[model samples]
Target: MKINKILNNNAVVVKEDDQEKIVMGAGIAFQKSKNDVISQSKIEKIFVMSEGNKKFQELLKTLPEDVIELAEEIISYAEGFLKVPLSNHIHISLTDHISFAIERLKQGFRIQNKLITEIKTLYAQEFSIGLWAIDLIEKRTGVAIPEDEAAHIALHIHTAKLGASTMENTMKHTTMINEMIGVLEEESGSTVDPEGISHQRMVTHLHFALNRIETGEPFHDMDPDMLELIQTKYEGAFVLSQKMAQFIKDEYEVSFPASEVGYIALHIQRVLERT
Candidate 1:
């Protein structure tokens, strides 16, 4: 591909397939001019923009090279762990976040994430990867990142999976799930196993439930007979589910529907059986 614009000594913008792509490598653009053919052997990473080239180009211009490289490495590791291809925008979002995080640390300003516990509980795999990312950052830059940053990193990864532009909704869902799980553990007197199938089911159920609640979508109608039977058969779990419903009502001011209570009770029953 021919160089369309030079970004730095190690980075350049190239036109490929009538589209602009930001390419980076060591000394890849040194002494290179516009319309010059870039050497394939020297290219280390290429970022194709889905939104536009302006913001990404600006990010590359201001973001430190080491931070960008760390973001790429973290995304690569996350993709391998998740066994799925992540959106290319993660390269931009994650790099910008890490760069700014480092700057904030240098300025002695640390922001605490209220959703850290929720992020760790709900997105265990991604959160574990986030911790690994923290270690990688500390080793490379000698700047130790707090656990709160891991939650932020995991939120970025979760947003990438949905191809979303912001982390607001994701953080809300995570926080709600965490609070629900906290209620479950409190009532059951045991910690819920995040890696268990039961826990996964509960998380999936709550995820969709929260989505419905957020969008004001009504729950599917259920048979009153079955709901009564579930409540009677799993009385303990039903009571816990009631507590969960009340928690949601108090926290979000959205009343949890009765039709969904039985389903939540069933999940709680399964979790209780497992624990």
Candidate 2:
């Protein structure tokens, strides 16, 4: 493919199959002009834009080579552990975030993530991988990132998985889920085992419930008879669900309708039965 534009000495934009891709390598674009054919042997990495995103090219041009390399290593490791393909946008977003984070740490600007606990509780696997990433970043870059960075990294992974626009909403949703679990535990006078199957189901239920709330979609419709039956049969769970609904409304300023209460009550009942 011929070079369509030059981003830097090591990177250039080229068109292949009528799609623009930014190609990068050591001295790949050095002394090269537009329309010059890039040698395959000199190519190290190629980034394809998702939905014509230009941020990746901008990041590749600006970020330090080592930072980009480190980000790639961490993402590769996460993919192996997750056993699922991640969005291509992860490379851009994560590299940009890590590069800025490293700069901030260098300047002695430390910011703690308030949602760290929620992230650890709700996304244990991703948070664990994020902690591992922290060690790897320090070992490779000699820059010690705080544990809070793990939460930020985990949120980045979560955002990529969900194709979300911002981390703020993801954190808010996580905090909501944690609060819901806390309410359930408080009502039951016991800690919910996060590792238990019931807790996992509750987490899943809360995730989708929050999503629907955010999108202004109605919660799953419950049959009137089933709702009443569940309310009577699982009185304790129904009571806890009421507390949950009120907690959600008070904290998030969003109403949790009765239809959702029945579904949430079922989840609570399952947890109570299992425990």
Candidate 3:
């Protein structure tokens, strides 16, 4: 095994002879520095791997089309699900976790399983954070997010890779946006129809949409056509939101707080923009 490139003081790139693979991970050889020999025992996790340099090259070749496409969805979902700063690596971690979690959820088992239970069992101090996320979502969106969604989202938001600032900002934006719907209605003086088709329904769908956007991920588990429809509707909602904001300021002398609108715009850009 030999060192390839050092990513940071505590991380490095290496080629493992057994697999003939080049992998990236956190390493113990922090002192030797970049382009220096690293001990095998120091590596923490293999972030990525390829059988050979050519294979690695090939993998990267379609990255723009496939790898990044998939990763973008993962990032979107993680942004909402975790409410944290996520890099491409966080996207990778979430992709791996969600694949299994979704499979388990599909198998008729609840998602708040042993791992979730362990959070309360082990680190009780942060248990309230999970509860807080669920409470905030429930209070703002009125959707009663499935318990499974709450548990998994809590995990993603609290993971080490997600910075505190990122998590806090995302959470604040999500909470505010969910609650902002009421203000829009108040300003518009429009009442939601009660014929099972109303602004209330739009609000609900927007909640779901915001959930995906906040997490910076796509709901691959959902039907592609249906997802497309939902995306279209959300875009329409975004435009409506902008109009409502303008109307509020113009007619009611009230504005959708600029800070809140900025976050709403981010959600719009992430969910409606074609990547």
The CA lDDT of each predicted structure is: 0.84, 0.83, 0.45
Regions of model 2 farther than 4 Å from truth: 2-10, 15-20, 26-37, 42-44, 48-53, 80-84, 117-125, 162-169, 182-201, 212-238, 250-253, 257-275
The order by descending lDDT is 1, 2, 3
Candidate of highest TM-score: 1
- The C-alpha RMSD in Å for every predicted model, in order, reads 4.0, 4.6, 17.7
lDDT tens per residue, model 2, 102-143: 999989998698667667767787898899999999998888
The weakest ten consecutive residues by lDDT in model 1 span 162-171
**Residue by residue across 31-62, what tens digits does model 3's lDDT show?**
66545666667653354453333443343343
In what order do the candidates fall by TM-score, top score first? 1, 2, 3
Name model 3 segments beyond 4 Å from true. Answer: 2-93, 108-165, 186-275
Residue 18 Cα positional deviation in candidate 3, in Å, after optimal superposition:
18
* Candidate with more favorable, higher TM-score: 1 or 2: 1
